[model samples]
Target chain A: MFSELNSILNTSPENCPQGEFTLVSDRKADASFLIHHFLSFYLRAGCKVCFLGLVQSFSHYSAVSQRLGVSLTQAREKGQLVFLEGLKGALGVLLEEEPSPGTHMLGFLRSPRSDLRELFEFVRASSTVLLSLGVRVGAVVDFAHYCRAFVCSKLQGNMVMLIRGEDEEEEECDEEGAEWLLRALTHQCSLALRVQGLPTGYCRDIHGQMEVFWRGHGSSVTGPQTQQKLFQYKVHDKGVSFFARGTSSAVL
Target chain B: MLLDIMQTNEVGGLVIIQDTVDCCGRQLLKGFIHCALKRDEVVHVLGFEVCENEFRGGLDSKFTQGLYFHDGYTDPLGWTECPPLTVHHFTPQDINTCLSQSEQLKTVTLVVDSLSWILRHHSPAIVCQRLQELRRGGALRSVLLLLHSDMHQQGIVGSLCHLATAVILVAPGMSGQHTVAKTTRRTKSGRVTREEECFSVSEDLTITIEAQSSCSGKTLPEPEEYEADPAANLTFNLRLSEVEREAKEKLSLPFVFSQEKKSALLHPRPGAGRILYEPDDNDDFDQEDPDDDLDV
Candidate 1:
């Protein structure tokens, strides 16, 4: 499904196992390119895609997909694409003031259920419906940090959960919290990748660095020893390009 | 200065000024507001970190008339020192409400000087969604200038950068003479473009791009050739030149070598021709008696 990204991860589509969950931990760089490219890979591979955008708007999401050469309208018309606007309702639940009466009929959040299992199940059920349509299903979830790892463990298909780390100061104080979350999510995923934006002064074009921690569960590739693969990346017109630092040749 | 890299006229866009904790983000923000005001754009500032007086202390008196300052930092009971032209004080919880109200009335720009504070109080997801709403919403024909510190809430910063139309990262350089400014913009064609330059903040609070800070034309240091004509390594010496060496010898203390001190060792050395007799000592003489009767 993913031509260049596969090699960057050291795994091809033919060897890619099903039901693998990959977590992309982004610090400073824009993760939209990675998420969009991941979705585009599946869409190009004829997989039915469902994007559960909790933090991003459908217009911005679809615009990015369209720019990546994925026809969002055509894919939707063919029952191959679906967008789940989860943020609006989620925000309503998270609001401090209670939703007043008569707002329930207007489809506002009226329930006081504090558990995120409902949200997780809602997204999972949507992906299952797509899976039952006799095609591969790929789901990209934004703001999955709000969902519990155990709840995310129940998801199906090729799932990718994008989590943003804390700021530099908070990260220093409550690093255990961030690391605990990373450990929890990494335990649930097959492949764990971290993309960090390098401090902006050192290089000209390269904006950030990405490292693959490991691939578990259903992959033929063994994890690296002593060191994992590292590549510097820059955002471009097509998408993002990954290159080995100090070398002009592209890694993917 | 800051707006030179951006489109100042386009309505419904978000501009983020990402400055380090030590850099002058507020000054750059002041510059942006003045630029917007010069274009006859009505500017509303939601201040959470700095008070109105402190915020306007660096700004010109004429530019302050066109600006509407919303103070989120000061409590309602706080005393003011300056005669307010257009300053409003609201409780912290009512910041979003105040923002929405001002956004509806403002004509040009909505500047939030403390997005980090807002993100702390609200969900990052909701904050980003609201910022996007303010960017595209028709209630306001305004652009957003979000001033954020580079030290805190980096995850939220990434999300904000993704949502923003333009992101200006300002960091103080090593020498402190200029600041490194990295601007990443999302073009109308949906392409992400990045530009890096150095800028110096002047005494007048204006930012000027340094002309000699292009990092593209820099060349790598040449590697040393090790195989061609290798030379022998030289030894390090502490001695001075010949004259100094002669002077040192003249001033040196006399070496009084003791002539063959034979008693220096624990046992005097036996002469080669001398014969020594061996003493016969019983092993029991050196050993203490097992039963000395001391226990009794």
Candidate 2:
């Protein structure tokens, strides 16, 4: 699903970039669709996947994964998948109780604190652990409402951050802090993709458009050639597929 | 209108009041508190931007007993000055404790005087996470009144607005005529409706909120005319298109047909001045030519 996106970033499944983060945002796209497609893309390529779901629970993810035929259970048994229920984990930490059974932890699991330093330590440790297991870890964090700073700054694995889109009417809204956050994340991440839902006429399926902004390195070594590509996409019975910008013709 | 909404909204509803730091604008928040207290609801004031004395000074002495102030700035370690009422420091770290405490109250209204204050010490992500947890846990039983000042963390306010069940935006309107408050409510059925009110702030800091009929969708004759020709009515004349605007120089010109100023033109007018034909004074003709020695 994200082959074009990976190719645009000049990254491959076998030789994946480490400690890099990508931000996927939209004002109205279903986050589950975007996140599941992203995870499925990486997992299909034989990469170890760790989904730290802050918005949706494990069961919800399992259902979506099952529908997509991703087989997260079999992958988990083979040590290729780790699903950390971040919402419950965060609630547990807030209540100072141990996360319930079958709960996996990441990013500062030892100390229960919101301090930036402590949070970065968690990212560093988690990535190191996953790397030591002889797998290239790609993590997907469903940042429905909130996410920490280190996830943008310190993670040592390929990261996909999912942020909920705001109302289009509130496009010029007073959330300067959130804008600043998007600005900061945009600068940190190699790719910033915006997925927006487009109204489908007569058809009941969910259709959307994806815009990928790939900024070439500004340094002297690599000549500046920033590229922005737009693709129309749709979520289907199998998974997601991208088509030409204004047409329904799928991009093979 | 806010009071009516407060009465009708469910117990777990979250309402946000976004106001400027101006004194008159801040008084409107007190009006909300007064409304909440009048309903016999226990109100918790999480004062992060303001102090206990600041909020207490505005209200009567009798109503102070029913109000509890969690002075976020004064108390560093979640300690309370008065006994019986436990007030905690409004730190990002202690957000869970605050939410849990509010969960225990059956008919309590939790009000954060200014959420932007927390954003100063912490990132928006952490604040948003805590708020999501608070909303999910149903801790906003009675009401969650989040008052955000436009002083800082302006962007995060959008996310907060997204999470709020109702939003009351207060702004200064038209040279003391009124303070406008636009309240947008998202019903339980997910329908959104917006209502606007024009309120006047009295000398004693009492805010009288009245409906702004002009802002409502129903057409009134005066507003209809105003909308038809806003510039003519002087309703909105701050901006005009280039074609409609009178030339800057033409405004200063009299009827006497003054010459168009050529000095302002970037390109110089050729043949406007005499060309000098002077010889080179530094050239020594006597030294260069031997025949000139006779004349010398």
Candidate 3:
């Protein structure tokens, strides 16, 4: 499903680098395709995947991954995938009585102050997996920081995070926090994939553009030379096609 | 030039290494560490972004004898029980206590791995005040701060820049060969110097600095001499020769009438009026004036 993206990244599913942080972000465009690509990509690599699904429920991802030829239900049955449905968990935390300390994964959401220690502890207990946090980071910027400090530094595992880019209509404070989180993650991540809409407005042939920035320093598994490239992409039912700028079919 | 500034210890007060998302300043931070160690000064690193081993991995071992690492990365909030050095508070007093734990009380170079983390947790005003208080205490020789410029608001970053004695901005160069560092330094005599240079950090933590191509010798490039030419390489001639000019003046176009022809067309002599009439076969000719019967 993501062979072209893999080729552009210069890595295969079998040889995916560990202990690296990959950040996927989008602006004025939907980047959910990238989240699905990484999910199926890592699962095919035979890594234990713990997906912190914050934006959607299990069935939605399951349906999408099934189209991409990866069975999330079977993976769960085999004890290789740990799925945390954030919306359902938050609902449960709201309806249920007060739980014991550090028992629930969404305990931080219940507290008045923003603390993610329990969440980090939960991830630590489920150790040595490719942790994916699919959430809007405007509310929990510190959680991303904690993940960078603990999961990437100590656990020796890879992390893939999805964050929405800034919007002009959003509140000033939330926009600032989201922008800051995006920049901070870009500085820390080994690879940054940014998807943005066409500046000239809506288009028929080309969906959007993506910029891939590979940080050279601190990434030993990848090459030492830094690289930045731009490509135009179109999302399909099962996959996405990435081509160079001005090379879309309509333009030709 | 940056190397010279670092070697001479001309930068004092608070020094900031401002970097963006594309380019990181950790290499420059390590270069500063190398300079401090070469000067035989005690060095203390308060690392919150990266662990101790990862921070000191590429540094030379012999120069690390005077270096001390305080562990703020492992458990900053003290969630775990036995962190070697926990950082539950960010007050200047707490940080001073952490620094005083080292046996050497002499003048030391204090390096904060990043000020962005601290700024995120605390208000910018409180952080700035603490930094000022830390600087005025007289125990530290100088303070080096690493700031992610894009991660903060313009006002916050501006305040930090205004507070610093020098600010070095690291950005990716045209190619990957070297990164660009633009340094803005304020001297003790209230003079300001700004220099931009390209530097590359080697695998062993050594930096090679070179001036940018445009500002290599600190002399502005001379402007090229320009001359105007309307028909530099045209195939057809745009200029007229003297003979062609005279011939053009003598020629009279059909639509342009002479003075005599214009006067003759506008007015005729008194007795020269005549009408040439050829009547058709169906026409009737009468010697009477046409309007005499209707009006006399």
Candidate 4:
């Protein structure tokens, strides 16, 4: 249902789109549950994923992957699997640029943009803006500036931006983000600009009309939605590559 | 050690304030997290509450999000009121419904902060089955259950240890607590090495590990330099030949090696059917003391 976002600290989006993550007293019994369900979804979906904050070598993913015949090395080289350190580097690269404008594979998500350029020039003319977690307060204020011209899309997506803590303001992601973007769409709201964050899920209605999101610091969000946040990498953990960039190409 | 793995990004580390945030276990968790932030790439702290459930004499969280993060500071002693980077909350029922709804949901890592309460809701088997479901999804990330060390021996917990990809056993050693991460799922054919480590949870959420003074003046790699990933593969074979040496040196117990493990420890026999029957010699002495004092 989504790109795998497995992490010791995060829930892999590949296995569960609207998944539930819990921190129990002991993870031993539950380790397999996470791996199986997540891999079932991720392998079928063909998403590039990562895992972060897990302990030891052959800890979780490696143990299972060795059993399943997946290669951590192949995944890493092919851009499918990743670790926390790799995730950090990816984040660094993405945040380094402003999101590129044009037709995108994951929409603007896979689309690369740099911070070195002057932004907000295109967002003012856009109707909806999808942002990343790394996008700071920049896109919000920019979207607010165009709030009258075009209704802004809610900030939520895979590989997204969020506060590092647990208490983010609650919003119905399925209903609100999609509905608001569509409402803005019907009115032909123009100039939607998002902060620069490459969230993990698909944009239900915010794509065609210049969707905007962010990739900067903010309050952490929790509840089941917290699980939806990116884990370091999903496919990366399994040591397999070959994820689906195109919406229809995710192969099991 | 637990502190090393806890600091690494491959694991989810937690500290629970039992009877107010200062249980010895909580101290262990705090100390480890404080040190982890300084050494790892990215460390996240999921801060949840444990308010008393007056009716049930239990605990629950104040907000929906059960997670919070405290980024490492230049110094662990400093504190701040700044909002956390992430927070997520949910009801129990919603949690179960999610897995069933997904077509092929892959839930790789499920790090439980405390097994005590979750176990309170269901059995270790129930948690185990859920984990089995997650493993059916795809490639697993890793699973870490952050519970007090005492739970290490419970059958319910032992079963979890049996199912764990890696079991990180931490106990207060002669010089604080030493962690031994053993992979229950791994069958490594290499030399196993054991080393001592120090722990402290900084004011920030990172867990710090310092080499014990015994190994001082020796140059060692930083926590990350220990290996590509020492924590996940970090194992001390409990069933290995070296266990006796650890018991003598680290555990300080009379570990008599025998053909079978059952004969090692003296514990109460299994329950008969659904009943528990045992007599403690300490209770018999205490019972006579009260009567003797009463001149009965």
Q: Which candidate comes out best when scored by DockQ?
A: 3
User: TM-scores for all candidates?
Assistant: 0.37, 0.38, 0.77, 0.25
Candidate 4 residue lDDT tens string, B145-258: 455433223566666654553454443333322322222222133223333444443333334564453543343456666657434555564444776767766643346554
Is 3 or 4 the stronger prediction by DockQ? 3
Error of 4 at B81 (Å): 32
Docking class of 2: incorrect
Candidate 2 lDDT over B88-123, as tens digits, reads 244434544554544355466767765655554557
lDDT of 1 by residue, B33-77 (tens): 766666666677876554455466655566666687875544221
Which tens-of-lDDT digit does each residue in A139-238 have in candidate 3? 3555655676666677766788888877543434333466767777787677889999988877888899999988754534222235789999988877
Find the candidate with the highest lDDT and give its number.
3
Cα lDDT, model 3, residue B111: 88
Clashing pairs in 3: none
Write down the worst ten-residue block by lDDT for model 1 chain A: A131-140
lDDT of 1 by residue, A130-186 (tens): 111101111111113212221222333576666665445243423135543554345
DockQ, every prediction:
0.01, 0.01, 0.24, 0.01
Tell me how far the alpha carbon of residue B107 in candidate 2 is from the true structure, in angstroms, after superposition: 67
Judging by TM-score against the true structure, name the best candidate: 3
Chain A TM-score per model, please list them. Answer: 0.71, 0.68, 0.87, 0.26
**Which sections of candidate 3 miss by over 4 Å?**
A94-103, A110-113, A128-139, A168-176, A217-226, A249-252, B10-12, B85-89, B100-107, B213-296
Candidate 2 - chain A - TM: 0.68
Q: Compared with the true structure, what per-residue lDDT tens digits does model 4 show for residues A148-168?
A: 222122211122111111122
lDDT of 2 by residue, A38-148 (tens): 676667767666665667677786777788777778877988777666667667765767657633343344443423233223343333111111111111111211122
